[model samples]
Target: MDMDGGWCSLEEIGPLSKLRRLTLHGLEDVSASSLAETARISSKEHLEYLELHWSSSGCMELRDEIEKQQQQEVVEEVLEKLCPPPRIHELHIKGYFGRTLPNWMMVVEACACKSLSILCLAYLPCCTKLADGLCRLPSLERLVIADAPAIKSIGSEFQASSSSSTVDGGVTESTSAAFPNLKYLSLVGLCEWEDWEWEEQTVDVTAGAMAMHALERLEIMKGKLSCLPPGLANNKRHALRELNLVELSNLTSVENFPSIVELIVCDCPKLKRISGLSRLHKIGIGRCPSVEVLQGVPSLHSIELEDGTIERLPGYLPCVNPKFLKLTCSKELHGSIISGSSSEWEKISHITKVVIYDIEDSDEG
Candidate 1:
C-alpha cells in the first residue's frame, strides 16, 4: 500500500499472517521506532521476504536524530518483539542509513533466521558491528554487500571463535564465523578502502579460513582492493568457476584461481601480468595499458582484448590452445598485429575457429 507521509502503526500490518512478501517504500513519516516494531510484530511464519525502502530526504535527517539511547531503546523493543521463533528465508533492505546496524539484525542472525538462505544489504554506511552481525547468520547461502562506503574490513566483532579443521593443509578456522553455507559472494562499490591490509600480518589468515567451502563464484567490483584476500588464494576447492575483477586500479597481479574456467579483467590500467590462473577457459581483458602476459592458463578457449595496447604477447602465447580470439585496436597499433609473426599462429589455426573483427573498418564505413 502507498503510505507516503501517512501515519501507520506496526499493529496495522501485524495480522498479515499469511503474507509471503511485503514492501514498504517512500515512507516519509514512519519513525525508525515504528518500522522496527512493524518488523518485530509482523507474523513471519509464512513471510519469506521483506523489502523496505525509505527514499525521502527527511529519512536521512531521521537517521541522525535516532542515535539517542532512548530512541535506540524503541528499536530494541521492536527487535525483541520481532524475533521470530523461526526465521524467514530471505531479507533485503535498501537505502538503510543508520550509523550502527540495528540490534534486530543480531536477533535475526542468532535465532529468528535459522532458515535464511539469502541476505543482501545495499547502500549502507560503514559499520563494523553490522558486518559482524551479518556473519552470525548460520544458514546463509548467498551474501551480497554492495556500495557500503565506510566498511574497511570484513571481520567484525561477531566473528565466530576459531575451530580446528583442515582443508588441503590450509588453516581452516577463524575466531569469527558467518556465512557457513554461502556459495556465492559479491562485494561492489566499497570505496573507502585504499588497501585491504588491516594488519601487519602477512595475510588475512582468519578471513580466508572462514570462506564457505561450497563457494563457486566471486565478483569484486570498484572496491579499494589493492590485493585479493589471502583466503581466496589458498582455498582448495576446485569449485570456483567464474571470477570478475573490474575497475580495481591498484590490483597488479592475479596469483590464484587453479580451477577457474572464466576470468574477466576490465578497467584495471596498472595490471602487469596474469600469472595465477592455471585452468582458465575464457579470458576478457579491457582498458589495461600495461598488461604484458596471459600465461599459465592452459584451458583458455576464448580471448577478448579491447582498448588495450601491449608491446608483445606473453612468451606463452605460442603455446595457447584457444578456439575463439577477438582483438580490437586503434589504427596506430594495427601495424603491430601485422608485424608480429605467428609463432602461435599454428596453434591458433589448429583451434576449432577464429574470427578477428577490425573496428577501424567499422569506424571508416
Candidate 2:
C-alpha cells in the first residue's frame, strides 16, 4: 500500500475482497484505465502477493519520445488493470516503463497465474520482451530479471514452445521443458543484454529441447553476455548447481557446466576460459584478468582468488586440486606465495590449506 503521489480513491480497493498481499507504489500516477478497473484486481481471489512500483521519476527520468510513448501508454493501462488474481504466488514489477508486458503474462494453457512461484522484473527502463508464455510455468520457482536496460535479445522464445498433444488419436509433437520447476535464476542489470539463443544441445531428453530443468542456481550480473544458452551452457542437461558471473563485459568462456558445484566470478572483463566443469566443488575468482583455464575440474574443494592486479601466482594455480586456498594477491602475488622457493610455492604445495592476503594487506583496499 504505497500508492505514492496522485490518483486515489481507486474504488477503495473495491472492498479489498480479502486481499492477501499487495503493494502499489506511484504506479506512474495512473490517470485512468477506468481508474484501474475500480481496484477489483482480478477479483482478488485470495491474492497471494503482488507489488507494482513505478516511479524512479517514472520511466527512468524520461528523455521524451512522444513523452515516452505517453508514459508507455499509461503504464500499459495500469498493468492491464493490475491483474493478479488466480492465486498469485509472488509477483514484483518495479519502476516499469512498459513496452508490452501485460496481457496477463501469456502462460496460456489456461493460465492466469498458475500459482506463480515468484517472478520479479525490476527497474525496467522500458521493457523489451521477456514475459512470453514464461515457458508455460508449471509452478515457476524463482525468476528475477533486474534493472532491465531495455533487454537486447533472448530468443528461442526463451525455451520450450512448439506444442501439440493429441496422442493415440492424432497429432503428436512434444518439447515441453522450460523452467519446469525452476530453482533459481537471476539476470541483473541487463545493460544491453547481448543475444542468448540456447544452443548447447544433446537432445535434452523427453523429445528434445529442455531448459532450466529444475535449475539449481544461476546468476548473471551486469550483462553483455557473449555466450551461454545451448539450453544453458550445454553439458547435456545436467541440473546446474551454482554459477554466478558478474560484470560480464563480454564473457569469453565458462565452458560446459556438467553439473557445476559452485563458481563465482566477478568483473568478467573478457573472461578467458574456466573450462568444463565436471562437478566442480568450489571457486571464487575476482577481477578476472584473462583467466587461463582451470580445465576439467576433478571435484575441487575450494579456492577463492582475488587479483588486485596480479604479478604472478595465477598460472591457474597448478590446475587446482583445492582443499582450501583463499589468497588475495598482488603484493607481487604475495611475495610469490611466501617465497617457499617460489613456483608460487610449488603451486600451492598440493593445497591442503593456504590463506594469503596481500594487496596492501587486505582490508578490501
Candidate 3:
C-alpha cells in the first residue's frame, strides 16, 4: 500500500511480519521520522534483502550547505528508525546524498546487519566516509562502492578499531580483523580520492588484526589512488589471487601482492613499475607505456601486451619469463620485429608461442 509519500504510509507494512524482501523507492519524498518506527522493520526477521533509494535529483550537487545538513539529519533519523534485522544478508543503498550514514550502519557494537554477506553502495555522491563498522562484518563476502566522487581519503575508520581491556593481570585483549570473510571487492569511479591512511597502531596487525585476510580478488580503477593503502599491502594472509588496476589516473606502481596469479593493467598512464610477485603466471597490459620495470615473477607463463604507439619492443620484454607472448603494436613496430636487423625476435626467442598484431591488420580483421 502506498500513500502520498509519507513515512506514516508505511504503517500498513508494519504488521506484515513475514515480508521476506522490501524495496522502498523515493525515500527522499518521506518525512516524519517518528512514524518510521511504527513500521516495525526490526520485527521483520525473515527479511533478507533490502533496498533504500532516494530520488536522483539531489545527488549531483548540493544546493547549499544548510539545506544539505538539514536533509542529512532527516534522512539519518528516518534510516535509524527503519533499521534492518541483525542477520539480514544483503543491503543496497543508492542515491544517498547524506554526508554521513546513519548510526545503525556505522557504530560497530550496534550495527544493523551483523550477518550481511553482500553489500553494495552506489551513486553516493555526498558521502565522505564509508560506514565505519563495515570491517566488523564477519560474513560479508562481496562489497562494492561505486561512483562516489567527493571522498578525498579512506582513513583508518575503514578498519575495525581494537578495544583494549586489562584484567587483574597486564594482559591486553584483542579484536578480530577487518573484512575477515571478504573475497571479492571493487572500488570504481571514485574520481576525487587522494589518500588511503591506514596507520599501523599498537593493536593493529601485530595481534592478528590483518584486514581483508580472506580477500581473493580486488579491483581498483578510475580513481586518484597514487598508492595502495597499508591495510592491503600489510595483509599477512597473502590470500589475494587476482589484482586488476585500470584507468587509475595517478597510480605509479603495482607490486607486493605475493599470492596474485593473474594481473591486469590497462590505461594507467603513469604506472611505471610492476615487480615482487613470486607466484604470478599471466599478465595482460594495454596502453600503459610508462612501465619501465617488470621483474621478479619467475613463474609467469603468458604475456598479452597492447601498445599502438611504440616503434620497438618494450625494454621490459627481455626481463619477463613468460613462454607465450601476444602483442599488439603499430605497423612500424611490427615491421621492426619482423626485420632481421631488429633484436625483437632475438629477445623473444625463448617464448614457445608468439602472436603479433599491427593496427592496420587489426582494423582489417
Candidate 4:
C-alpha cells in the first residue's frame, strides 16, 4: 500500500498483520519515535518486503538535532524498536543520510529473514560502513548501491581490519572468510571515486580470487575506473560471464576475459583497442572515438560499432563470422560507400547480415 507524505499512526498498522509487503515513501512527518512505536505493535509477522524513502524536507527540519551525538543515539534506539523482525526478505532504503547504519541494519541478527536475498541502498550520503555490514548477510545474492558519493572505498576496511590483526598476531582462520555467497554487484553514479585502488587494507589477490570464483556478473557504470581491479585480472580463469563498462571516460584498455560471452563498452571515448576477448559471442561498442580494431575474439556472432575514429575496418574483421553485424560511421565514409572504393566496404560482404548506415541517416531516420 502507498503511504507517502502521510501520518501513519503506530496503532493503525497493528491490524494489518497479514500484509506481505509495505512501502513508506517520502515519509515527511513520520518521526523516528512513532516509527519505532509502530514496529513494536505491528503484527505483520509475514511481511516479506519493506521499502523506506526518507523525505528531504524531513531531514532538513531535524538537521541540527540529527547532527548531535545524543540525538543520533535516540534515532538508533527508535529505529531498533521500529524494525520488524528479519521476516522482510527485500529491504530498500532511499535518501537515508544518517552517518552510520541504522541500528536495525545489523547484518548478524537482521539476516534472520530466511528469504532475504536483495538489498538496495540509494542516495545514502553517509554510508561508509554499510558495505561491511552488508557482506555479513548470509543469504544476500544481489546488491545495488547508487549515488552514494561519500562511499570512498568498499571491501577496503574489511581488508584493513584483517591486516591490523595479522600485524598484531591476532589473525585466526576465522578471519579469512567474508561474503562467501555474493554473486552479483552493481555500482553506479559514484562520481567522486577515481579508481578502485589496491591499498594495504584492500582485499588480497587470493581473497579477490575467491570472490571472483563465485561472481558471475559485474556492471560498473559512470565511474572513473582506469583499469580492472588486480584481483579480477589475476583470477581471470573464474566463472564470470558478462562485463559491462558504461560512460567510464578514463578507461582505456580491457584485460582479458576468456570466459565472458557478452562485452558492452559504451561512451568510453578514449578506448582505442580491445584485446583478449576470445570467448566473446556478443559485443556492443558505441561512441568510442579511438577504437580502431576488433581483435582476439574468434567466436563473436553479434557485433555493433558506432561513432569510431577508424576510417576502415580493423585488420581483425575477416576473422569474425558474425551473424548480425551493424556499423554506423562518419558521413565521409558514406561517400566512399556510394563510390564503391572504400576498402572497409569490401569486408562487409563477409558478415552474414551486414547493415551499414551513415551516422546522419542512422540518427535522423
Output the number of the TM-score-best candidate. 3
Model 4 pairs in collision: none
Worst 10 residues of 2 by lDDT: 200-209
Candidate 3 lDDT over residue span 93-143, tens digit each: 888777787777787563557788999999887788888778777789999
The global C-alpha lDDT for each of the candidates, from Candidate 1 onward, is 0.62, 0.79, 0.80, 0.65
Looking at model 1, report the run of 10 residues with the lowest lDDT sum. Answer: 197-206
- Give per-residue CA lDDT, model 1, range 1-365, as digits (tens): 24345645555666657777666664333555556556443455787776665442443345465444444344334334444435478777666554566655653435647787887877765343345555556677888878788776554233343234666769664444445667788888876655542221234444334445456788888866767655556546466788899988787887666878888899887788886677888988877777776778777888876662444344444566787777666644444454445443443455566554345674577
Residue 53 Cα positional deviation in candidate 1, in Å, after optimal superposition: 1.1
lDDT at 198 for candidate 2? 67
| Root-mean-square deviation of candidate 2 | 15.3
lDDT of 3 at 134: 80
- Higher-ranked by lDDT: 3 or 4: 3
Note the clash tally of each candidate.
Answer: 8, 4, 0, 0
Q: Is candidate 1 or candidate 2 better by TM-score?
A: 1
Model 4 superposed RMSD (Cα): 4.9
Q: Give per-model CA RMSD.
A: 5.8, 15.3, 3.3, 4.9
With a 3 Å backbone cut-off (N, CA, C), the pairs that clash in candidate 2 are 198-229, 199-229, 199-230, 200-230
Backbone clashes in model 1, listed as residue pairs = 40-82, 87-112, 135-178, 159-176, 160-175, 160-176, 160-177, 208-231
**Tens-place lDDT digits, model 2, residues 1-365:** 35434445657866879978878877678777787888888888998998988785645566787887877888798888888887889999888777878877754455568888999988877788887687677788999999888889988876755365767758565646676788899999989999997664464354234667678899999979877766676655567789899998998888878788999999987888888788889989998878888888898898898878867766878876889999887777787668788776897889889988886778666
